[model samples]
Target: MATDAVKKYLEDTNRPYSCADVTVNLRGAFTKSAIQKALDALSEAGKIKCKLYGKQKVYAAIQHDNADGPSENEDYDTPIKTTTIELEELNTQLKTKEASLKSLLAAPTSDSARVQAGEIKTNIEKLESRLATLRDSVEVMSADEKRGILESHAKLLSEYKKRKRICSEMIEAMLEGYPKSKKNFLEELCIETDEMVDFKLVSFQV
Candidate 1:
């Protein structure tokens, strides 16, 4: 949805985009890695200006005004918005997980199992509803707003990617010829989105 808003802004204002600029436009949070990915994507497709500014890189919408700093990637775009393309891709992720979540409905041979299946379905439905709401909100933000959110996200992602990369390289060197690297790698990956949140009700004794 932020993607759509970004596209619309670019089309209407004919403004060039940078990762920071896009972040502001999308108003959604993205990690530094995510920003880099988006910047690389837009750069490759000829949509934005991405340049290395000494210590850091600068990004902006393409063909509007060139930064005085040296340019690393010369890419700009037409009216085509890859955000739409991205949404389709994200949709595939949801679809792939849908079956896994829904697969619990197999006729339960036990009463407890039947309740478990119902509980899973209920949780799944709630998750879906929250996702739908967030998606719609993302879709509706203005390009400037989107850009701000993206900028914040990019800042986060940049740090995250740097740390992850370092951790991975260190692991690679430390664990050379050692087994279980795959598990470690996955644990690292799942640290953010894979953890299950648990809650409980308890009576406090006074």
Candidate 2:
């Protein structure tokens, strides 16, 4: 489906389009990676032509005329591939295993075999739940939302590192005059927010 969307978008456009441009236009429908995959597929199918410009890959739709002959790769439209339903088969297998496990659990007395069956059932349940969660996520999640979350996490980590660096610098300055062996100095080095604040205030006075 994404490949078809990409083809259509390129067909409508007069100039070449980059993966980022296609991804932005598609937005919630497909991710940047997905768009690139589609672009690769289109290139392979000869529906599009790719040219490298510096570090970027740009794609242009192949033009064809009704009266003209076909190129090496036919420039005719093809059916858009749809997502497969292999997950349905997995669900059926999981259900069968769950029923068998239930029967084993209903047996009169506990045995090693039953214990193994229970463990198997727990594993199956975990796998089934995980697959279901993934399916749901794929259906509802957007690439932009995921990127935003990642960007926020990276920003927080950057700020944390900067703060730690400032504190380390302040602590190292404070110990400049202390007489101690390098090993002992490194082992004793510790930096805290209050100490950093004090160091900044002292620096201001000097």
Each prediction's Cα lDDT score?
A: 0.60, 0.71
Candidate 2 lDDT by residue in tens digits, 99-135: 9999978876657779888999999999999988988
Backbone N/Cα/C clashes per model? 31, 0
What are the models' TM-scores? Answer: 0.23, 0.32
Residue-by-residue lDDT tens digits, candidate 1, 81-145: 45435657999999988877777665455888889989999999999999889887846768787
Worst 10 residues of 1 by lDDT: 197-206
Predicted model with the maximum TM-score: 2
* Candidate 2 C-alpha error for residue 32, in Å: 0.6
